[model samples]
Target: MNTTSLPKPNSMEFDIHAKLKAANSHWSYCYAVHPHDKGFDYQFNTTFVGEMEFAVYERIENYFVLVDFFKSYDEACDDAKKIIDDHPDIKKMFSVS
Candidate 1:
């Protein structure tokens, strides 16, 4: 038998990390949260390579902003859905499936 210790993730941290991992499967990207923003800001890149990369950001309070360089809106949507599916708790947050 093998046992591995995975660090326990807080609710918000788990949601964000899970979402980002799901997004990465479809879009070659990286996601991170800004500590100073109190989880209000998230950053993601839509490309595997650096030079042609694009970032997408969402501000928890105000709006969801699309930063365009490449990639389709549909892809982003699908990625978002995958994230929700990967973590059911997120659906519970809005009381929907």
Candidate 2:
């Protein structure tokens, strides 16, 4: 019996891009905090689902790459600040520029 295969994702793709855009637009305002280094940054934002998340990014060249995620904003920021206060060169190690 010859069987037909399902269409590829891009062949008849749903409005996935639009959906993602809408979802991303609904997220709360983001706060960029913890001035680590020239090439390292930290930010925290709440999602549309009301979940809070913090992100750590490291810059390679012209763009930044996500390094890690944390759960609490206050906790993460406090911990990061403490680390920076204790060791100013911690974030500099991850910096590219």
Candidate 3:
């Protein structure tokens, strides 16, 4: 099987990383798509490392806290958007006026 024969994606929106200020601190919070690794598995390591997934995380001081993961890009983006839109603190963190 030649994986290279597959058509390229029409858009790269999934690769866009959204970084925002933490609600309670000066640290950063980000959500983005990444390839699966040994650390995370949706079904007991059934998925390979090449598989793409979305992750939401927060950086506090010198450490990071993983919030959630989504199998699809849309799912992750939607949830992040909802969180910002529905929460006053999160919404205000956005630089866009």
Using all chains and alpha carbons, the TM-scores for the candidates as numbered come to 0.23, 0.29, 0.27
Per-residue alpha-carbon lDDT of model 2 for 1-97, expressed as tens digits?
Answer: 1122222234543432342244353322233333454544433222323444444444445444443333333333333444434544544533466
Q: Which number leads on lDDT?
A: 1
Point out the higher-scoring one by TM-score: 1 or 3: 3
* Steric clash count of candidate 3: 0
- The prediction achieving the highest TM-score against the true structure is 2
Residue by residue across 1-97, what tens digits does model 1's lDDT show?
Answer: 1122223334533343454444442332333434565745544444544223334555545444433222332323434544444556543543424
lDDT of each: 0.39, 0.37, 0.36
State model 3's lDDT: 0.36
What digit string (tens of lDDT, one per residue) describes model 3 on residues 36-55?
Answer: 43343121111234544334
Q: Which stretches of candidate 1 lie over 4 Å from their true place?
A: 1-32, 36-76, 94-97
> Considering summed lDDT, which 10 consecutive residues are worst modelled in model 2?
1-10
Task: Give the poorly placed runs of model 2, Cα more than 4 Å off.
Answer: 1-48, 73-97
Please give the lDDT score at residue 72 for candidate 3: 39
- Prediction RMSDs, each to the true structure: 13.3, 15.1, 16.2
Clashing pairs in 2: none
